[model samples]
Every structure is written in C-alpha cells, then in structure tokens.
Target: MATQIVTSEANTAAVPGEALEFDDIQGLVFFGHGHLKYSRYVFLRMKDGKQARARAWLRTLLERKEVSTASGKQHPGLKDVKGEHALQVAFTYSGLKALGLSPEVMTTFLQEFREGMRDERRARILGDTGGSAPEKWQVGGDATMAHVVLVLFGKDDADLDVFHASHRDCYQEALEEVFIQDADMRQGDTEPFGFRDGISFPYIKGVPTTRGSDALGLPINAGEFILGYHNAYGQYPFSPRVPRSQDPGNLLPDVPRSQRVSGEPRPKDLGRNGTYLVIRKLRQDVAGFWKFVEENSRDPDKSAEENEANKELLAAKLVGRWRSGAPVELCPMKDDPTLGADSARNNHFEFRDDPYGVKCPLSSHVRRSNPRDTLVDDPQESIKLGSRHLIIRRGRPYHDKFADGAEEQGLMFVALNTNIGRQFEFIQQTWMNNPKFSDLYDSKDPIAGDNYDPEYPGDEPKDYTAVVPGFPVRQRLTGLPRFVHTRGGDYFFLPGIKALRYLSMERTP
Candidate 1:
C-alpha cells in the first residue's frame, strides 16, 4: 500500500531575502539526509584541517545541534524529520575557491569521507554509483569544464587562473587521481532541451523566500522547503497540507507501506522545499538521428535539398518544440527563433486551442513531456493539470569530442522538482517514454522514442498515415531506427541553507 501524507497544522515563520545574505555567484555544494547529527559529522570530516576560521566555524555548528523545524513534520504527508535524510549542505563557489589547496595536491592528499576517529560510523555518502566513469567523463557545456573541474577538486582561487591557463596535464592527472580513486559527488544544471524543466521545484518551507511557481502551479512556500518555517517578514506562515486519495498501485515492491512515495507529493511544510536531483550524462547520436530522418522523409522523390528540408521537418515534429524553443503546437512549420530565444514567452503557452497535432504533433517531446491542457481539455481538468506538470530545468549541452569527429553529444539533463516521483519520473516513463498517452492512442515521443513499439507483435507496417491538419497527408518514409538511449541515474535531495550549515558541523545528535 502507498503511504498517505499527514498534513501538519503548525504555523512557521519565514526569513526575508535580506536576512538570508549569501553570494549567489560562488559555486555551492548541497547534501541532504534525515539526521542533523549525521550531517554535522560529515561536515566536520569535510572541513577537517582546513583554515582555522573555517574549522572553528564548523566546530560552532556542531555545538548547535538543533535546526528549527515546523511542527517537526515538514511536509505534512510526503516526508518527516526521522526518515527524512538531513538534506544539508551548500558551499559557495568562491568559498570553494577559498579552500586554499591546489587541485593536484588536494586530489593526492584528500582524506576519505569518513572521520578518522569514527571509522565504525561510516558516512553513507559513498554510493555504489554516480560520479565519473573511466570511459565517459562529463563536464557541463554551459559552464567551463576547467572551472567545474577545479571546483570539484577543491582548488582555491589563487591557482584557478594559472591552472585554467595551461594546467591540462596537471588538471587531468589530478582529476583522474580524485575521480578514479573514489566516487565523488557531481552536480550541474540540465541543458536547454526546449522545455521549461525546473520551474516546478517545490519551495523550501523555510528557505527560498523568493516566490516562484512550482510544477504543481502553486505559489512556493519557504516553510514547505526549509527547516525553519519562517517567512520574508520574519513571520511564521500557516498552510495546512491538503490530503488526497492514495493509490495503492503506485507503490514499488519492498517499499515500506508506512512511507508514502509517489510522483506528486504536496509541498505543505518547510523542510519539503529542497528537491531531489537526479543527473545523467546522456550522449546523443545526432548523425544517426538525422540519418533516420533522411531515409524516412515522405518526399523522397523531391530534390536533394527538398529531402533535407523534409528530414529537418520530421526532426521538428518529433521534438514537438523547435531547437529554437518554440512549441510546434504554436508554430508548426517554420521556427520562430526570436520567440524560442525569448524567456518571457518561450514557456508560456500550451496545446489547448490546438490539439489533434495540427500545430504540434501529440508525440512531440515537449507535448509528451507535459501534455499541458491537452491531456485534460475540460476547463476544470485543465485547472487541475495546470497546477501539475511544472518543472524548472537547468541543463547544458555536451559533446563527445571537442573539435569534430567522434560520437556523443546531447544534454546534461538536470531536473529540479518538489517531488521527483510525481514530476520527473512521471514525465519520463508515463509521458515521454510511453508510446501511448492515456487513451489518446499509440505514438512514440519524437525526441525519446525508446519504446517506439516495444510490444508490437507483428512486423511494423511500412504503409502508415503521417497526417497533420493543414499539411498534406503523406506516406511513411521507408525506415527509421531508435536514436536515444538511457545510460544511468539515481535520486538525490538538494538541501536548504540551514541544512548545509548543520551538515558541516557534525551536529545531528
């Protein structure tokens, strides 16, 4: 049975942005978990033998064991203080640069994550997976690889400029020393994959006084995402968790019935603000994708240039949104590069006025990812879904090789949402990965057609209807093969500011 969410009636206060003073330019490190004591212990280990002030500051945090909580039941139904991982840690980019160590030196001298004194109490931080793989190392395309590499290795600013200039040998050597020896934690935003990815992050209950829309289309509450239930005015805000019917079929085997785990958990408490981030280094087969398009164009009899145009059109249709970011549901044919690049209007529309794939095919990546108003067309249904399917995607593109030939390239797909089960996976398996969208019919997501016809018993028929309203109906082009492939992934919770402070001090108890 799926666990039910228990709404809390506690009133918590929020802290204003001014009160929470922190530099955003610096790179930050985030770690999340259930216990404050465990977090502090880890922090102590992380900061050991560092600057005296940093060490002393960490010592002070250890002494301050308790972090504020809202009714001690952060998210009324989804998670609680005990089962909840501490959900801690945030290190500024500059602060990391101030660590005062060279990447090469630190990589060689780094201590294991566990404390020397408490070897029996191993830090659960080391997972079986995540971090760099020997054959496929990754770096964010949006940010400089040198910067990220240095940050990951904990090199201070004094060495950054020199190292970045001509330390490839030193840098690569150090990176291998650290990454290859032990699995280090990795972080980065998602790429610009035409859809608004992270907009749906759950507001931290006591953090993120910055008001924003979440995937569920509701106002973000600080108390819902952080430990302390305080507001911008330094006042406690009260909002009761709204309960809904529990679906038994949603539970995975071996998952405890006592703990509710679903895709859409209500963000009703402060500590619930931090979202779990799952990062995957996916390599796209761009050449293969285009080749499939070329062979499958309806107008093969046309000139070579016409054939190429048709292939590009097919690519646009599958993605549902142009590379420029315009939704095909809105601009079906030619891309409005201006609109796609505009943040103000890029993610603002839905496929309501025009369904039936007339403008955007139902199977377009964006459309399938979030059917938006199309799935539940009725006004009331739209209202319900409007609050749902919202996510803030911060991703960057990556290529297999720097200059030219080689194979991989695509997105460093990073997605942030209040509820991973509800938002991310729901979009992946149910929408993008699923061939059939509810009762609509069978169709593969154009961008990710992994399950093009996973269960079709008969040989795929060459004759098929490729129709879109206002466009000429065409016959299916000869052949097309699956292009995308999933490499690996795991879930992680991003903690709030207070959580980070607590983690560094080794103070959970």
Candidate 2:
C-alpha cells in the first residue's frame, strides 16, 4: 500500500503542486544528516549465484525498518530531521543484474548509469587521466567494481561501530565486502583544504523544508531530483519500469496514465520517488595547494601582514569563496566571517553585477561549477537555463592514515540528480573541465579542474593558468598544479522504499 499523501505548507504556498510521498522517498534526498558526524560507505559485491540470499537480506532490512525515509518531522532552520543513525542502500548496474532483473527492464535505465563512471569514454570526459585515471583507482574500477554500497551514518564513532557491527553478518552469505570508505564532518563543516563545504543545495519543490535564500528565488521542480514527477523541462525524466506481468505482487506503483503508450499494458514504476547517486572519492593536496598559493603570492618588498593578505586573496579567487564560505563575489576586498556565517546573506548574491569577473573569476571553482546568472545576457534567463543542471550535494570530507603509513584525506563527493548526464556530467565536462569555460583561452576550474595530463594526449594545454580580472590589466597566475585528484567513484541507483520491496520479491514463473 502507498503511504498517505501529505501536502506541505511550503509547497502549497510556493507552488501549486501535488503532495509529496515522503514515506516513499529516501531521507538522504532531503537531508545530509549533518548531525550524524560519522559516516561509512561499505561497498559490497553480490556472491555468485546468491540471488535468493541477496533478496532475503533486502527483505530483512525492509521488514526491520532499518532504511531511513523522509517522513519524520522537519528540523528548524535545516532540512533534516533529528536522527541517531541513518541507513541508505543503493545498487550499481551489476547489482541490479545480480538480483535477476530482466534484460529488457535493465535497458530502460539511463545509459550513463549502465556504462558507469569508470567507462573509458566517460573517464576521458570526466578528466580522469594521469594520476586520477580509472586504472589507478583504489575502488569502483573494473577489478574493484562494487555491486552495492551501504551508506551508514551515526551521531558518533561508537554509534557507527555498533550500527555497522550489528548488521555486519546479515549479508555475509549474500555479498562479499569489496572496500570501505569512512568520512566524518570536520569542525565548522570545513574540508581537508580548510574551507567551508556543503554550503549550496537546490530547494526542491514540495520538500516541505525552509531553504530560505539558498534557492536564489527559484525552487527546482521535484522531478529534477526525484523521478515520476514533472521536471523543469515540463516533462517526466526517463525512469526504469517493469512490465505488469513481472510485478504480479503489485509491490510497485503504476505508471502514470499520461506516460503510458496507447496499446501497451501499464507497467510498474521501478524508479518512482528514486534518484541517481554519483559518488567520487576526491583526494585534495592540502600541502601542495597552500604551497602554490604562498609561492605565487610571496613578495619580499611587502610587509608580512600585507603578504599574508595577498596570499589569502589569491586562494579565495581560486576557490571563488573565502575560507569561511563567504563568496568573493559578495566581499571582494576582504574576508567577512560575519557574512560567511550568515545563512540568509551568504548565498543570496548573483554574478550579474560582477560580469567582468573582477570579484569572482570566471574560472574559479564555484563559478565554473555553477555559473549562476552569468551564462547569458539576461540574468533571469541564465538562471532558468542553469536551473536545469542543478544537483543536490550530500558529500562529506574524509581523513585517514592507512596501515601502510600512507595518508588519505579528501572529500567523498556525493551528489543526487535525476539525469546524471545532463546534470553531473555536463557540469564536470562542459563547465569545470572545459578549458574554454567563460571564454577563457586556457583555464579550467582553478581548484577542482583536471588542468593538464601529460600521459593522456588531448586538446588540454600543457600549462594551467588561473585568470583574475582586474582594473589596469588582468593578472594571470600560471604554472598551477593539479590540486584535486580522483581516487575512485561510481554511479548508483537509489531506489524508493516500495521499489526496494519490489526488487526483493521473487519473480513469478
């Protein structure tokens, strides 16, 4: 049975929309679970010929109500509800196939999800070359592919330990552990690079949470993040489905009437209220990043304080925001801790006024990731165009020193989108990795872009540059090194609650 529909006051007043099925949607879609500081991503591969055991394990999780949902009371000033622990399950293409999904139904999924993140063509487009190549990836590569990923979150390390241990043996017969990635929220939500993170998120219509000014006066359509609804393009995004015969138990929702083909039987919605998850393990070179900034900004003639200020400015221009999360576009002259901490004013500004990129450089990390009102001559038109590519980020920074005396510290870059190609890949390839973004001749995103790779030959320039627009003449900072490197990543489909139940059901002969 479907959960009772509940309309939100925010959705009712903001947009004329139908009630959202919070009970069916996963909690991670709405909440980052910031309060739960400890997180573990356990990657597993289904045991060969253990489809029945795997289905039984999923049924156990659903029956125990271990999976988190978005039905709880909303928190004040934040989108998440108070929780001691959160558990989310997602499946790779291989995982779905292991569960015995028919080939015809599998073909209905997005091509990007089918090919995966480590596909050779995808790796090239994602700039995963040189040290960041898929062959060098520690996980989610061809040899280390994971069929399933269990996202576990807890309020503390003890809580996480207990939660993980409790379920450790539940799927032992059905799955084999491939790898584990653990992450914790740093103080003040800063990443290893010492900058505030998780500052931007799209306000989904009918979500029933206060986004304040973060939405930038535009709430994205629910279908942009969730399937089975109308997207910003005024059409339903392609979602995988199953024939009615396959779902004899009626564990899934029916395909909407408008979406049904004239003579075809009504199929079951396998992707309703679900979304795609893109997870990338990005390793940041903290020492190298500061060293480059210090080396480039040093001036013997200037006082130590003046030199320090110059260094901070250069680093801020590269990141497009001060260390405290205040966008340079809002305060170009100096760092404003007050404005950075103010949620109402921090993300409320636009780049239209700084058209020349004097404040925030066109090639800066934030600017490239989200051009925001600077894509076209008309600011409103640009915002509308940009809205289509928006993604909800729900990642956390990780730090760990392995037993081999190697240190690993970076961000577990996680994002949710209905269309991985149009949203995530488009931003990664067309905006961040593209050297010609914002009309710059040879500049990529200063902080996170794949600037150059000697091993892989392409149109990428040999040298990297960070351009800063100025009054007398624009200053170009050259000889930049790759600051962020991709370690491992993959695309997974986060199914809805009912879909999980449906997937767990045995097919009728």
Clashing pairs in 2: none
- Mind giving the per-residue lDDT tens digits that candidate 1 earns over 1-509? 11232333441233223222121101121112212211111111122344444534433433442222222333222223343322122222223333332232123211321121112221112111122221223321112111111111212223333433342332232222111011111222223232323322333332332223222333433322222234323333221121222212221112122223376353222122333344444556677767666666656568988776666667677776666656566677777878666544555666667756767766666667766666674744663453344444533444444465654556545454444444555676577655457444444555554432222344263422233344445333322334454333223334343333322332111
Error of 1 at 245 (Å): 34
Q: For candidate 2, which ten residues in a row score worst on lDDT? A: 72-81
lDDT against the true structure, each candidate: 0.38, 0.85
lDDT of 2 by residue, 1-509 (tens): 33443444443233445466778888889888877889999999999888899999999999988888876443222243566788999999989988999997899899999999999999988989988999999889999999999999988888899999887879898999898999998464898888888777776666554444443577778899998888889888899999988888888888898887788699888999899999999999899899988987788998999989988988888898999999999898689999888776778878988887999888989999999998999888888899999999998999878799999789999999999999999999999989888888788887889875555555344468888876124778786678889999999999998999988887632
Question: Best candidate, TM-score-wise?
Answer: 2
Task: Give the winner by lDDT.
Answer: 2
